[model samples]
Target: MKIKTTEQYNRIIQGATAILLTEGLAAFSTTKVAKHIQMAQSNIYVYFKNKDDLLVSVFRYHQKKYIQFLVDRIDLSLPPTDALRNLVSTLDEFHRTNKESLDVIWSIRQSTTLRQLIPKVSDDQIFIAIFQWLKDWQHQGTVRQLPLMYLTNLVFSAIIDYFQLIDSKEMSPNELAIEEIVPPLSALLFV
Candidate 1:
């Protein structure tokens, strides 16, 4: 598998996502991903060292894309409170639009083998940026003066919980609207 253009690399990652989503991690392999994208198995090896590397790469690729999406939509010039709101809203939009990718991510996190490869995927660049923003807000007295880890969990847990509720059919569409949830989340996290 000779080196090639970026598109080819993207195609491999896309195929890997599809395989994880449809086949579960137990069935994931370079061979399957290669077959999924109609490429040679060795080609996947050229880009990724092994199965775990490929899985981690796929997760990182999607995570970066998701973070970029939020960054592009969020207005950094706004006050911290408003910017946090924008971040939450952008996250909701990203989750809605990228459900399958999100599903693949969730699946990867749940897999014991893959989870070990990138145990702290949440600590990636996107989260570091958000954590820094939160710390700045705390310093400015805009957000509550809590441990950054607790604050990060508070906001992210709410978002994840809301998605789980919707996915489990525990919350009806109307009940889970961002407008209905963001206010409470804002009150809970912001000063």
Candidate 2:
């Protein structure tokens, strides 16, 4: 087995994450990651048990970054409208930055087993901030009083559907159509 220096280990993991983000998890392999990092395949084995373990680590790393983005963007003290707008902007930025990985994430969601493997914003502490903001909005009568879980899942599903529509090349709807529909759909559930 080739033992990697600490820096080399981090480099390998970073390279592995790039592969997953660009090629999707299905195409991500330890050998490819090692090659990207200019390290031996055995060096990766020194840091990870196997490809599955490495993929999970990479998924967790990106998920945590996304959670941080949301946390930094949302101000619980702000009015509901402002908070929601900020949240949307944060998500738009995330989707824009990881467009390829986001598409891959959608593909992974098709596999129920894989969905379990991917970490979620809800599972992170930052999402608790969102929950608190929602509760505050409900108390102020600015938003609906539905259970947070119900609303969360509802919004999540709607957003996923919107992305799917965009991903479906054959459907060929204009971008304006999605932009027009998504806000109202989210607003209906939110308020």
Candidate 3:
């Protein structure tokens, strides 16, 4: 097993995700993952040190994929309200599409070992784009002139809680959509 470029490294991560999605994380053994990618388990060792490394890589890969999915689907040219709607809706759609992956991600506790394995994506980078959109609405007097970072945290906090509730089975997706998601977000951003 020889080390190679970033793309091959990513493919191993992707292979782990495919196994997790189909077989559930409990069954996502390194041998099974190697078979999924048509490689030897020894080959994976060349890239990821062990099972935890592979799991963390998979989580990071999925996070990037989720963000890119939203980036691709969202319309930046739209007005603030419309653009915000598109972004939120894209998140909702992502949760629906990758529910299992999200479940696995949430299951990973923020312990030192797991935290060390996971890569960091800055919250500021994600929110800066949102703030730029909100800036246009603020100028038009459609939104309040609040601190962009604060507002960004507020919105994502709500979204994360919603996902947690859904993941816990405390709220069904329909309840989340009608009772929690659409109404409250509308009030926060539009009203």
Candidate 4:
């Protein structure tokens, strides 16, 4: 019941993520996650309060990792267009390289039923950093004055949606390259 190490905890999350990606959230359970990782179900219980906690944690974990990746790549001090390009490029790169993890989360967002089931968790500053940067740019009239949520979602969802199409084989892998994506995305976000 005592969660031992960070590595083990992350392994459990990654195992649950695999289940979510392959079997869908409707099929996810701590027992399946345990079996997927070849561990006792109680070990998952030790780390999480219950199924929802574990589920929320899985989403939160992946989001935090991705936000950190994006934030690290774009300098807040840069001109808005330059920063937006960096943001777009980083996101496209993430989609190309981190398909497996992105598949789990992007699918979750696509499902209204799954969205309502997962409990909301408070986010750390890392989660707020990207939004804050966008907000700062908006205040300076560099970014669009539209609702921040919509603005952010448009940029991220566009890239992920395309990648999801490719992952589902609904679209060809070569349908769109990063070069074609970034310029339009940067234009859409910055003035």
Instruction: Please give the CA lDDT of all the candidate structures.
Output: 0.80, 0.66, 0.71, 0.73
Best by TM-score: 1
lDDT of 4: 0.73
Off by over 4 Å in 4: 1-3, 110-145
lDDT of 2 by residue, 28-51 (tens): 789888888887898677888887
Ordering by lDDT? 1, 4, 3, 2
Query: Between 3 and 4, whose lDDT is larger?
Result: 4
Regions of model 1 farther than 4 Å from truth: 119-122
Error of 2 at 155 (Å): 2.1
lDDT of 1 by residue, 24-79 (tens): 88878888888889998987777888888989999888877776787678775677
Among the numbered candidates, top lDDT falls to 1
Give the C-alpha miss distance for residue 54 in model 4, angstroms: 1.6
Q: Is candidate 1 or candidate 3 better by lDDT?
A: 1
Q: Would you list the clashing residue pairs of candidate 2?
A: none
lDDT of 3 by residue, 1-191 (tens): 47577987878877887887688656669999898889878988998888987888777766667667777787857866566667777777888898765655655434456765665433423556777776677778776677766777677778878877877799887765723454566567653
- Predicted structure 4: clash tally: 0
Q: Residue 106 error for model 4, in Å?
A: 2.5
Residue-level error in angstroms, candidate 4, position 172: 3.8
What is the Å distance of residue 34 in model 4 from its true position?
Answer: 2.4
Stronger candidate by TM-score (2 vs 4): 4
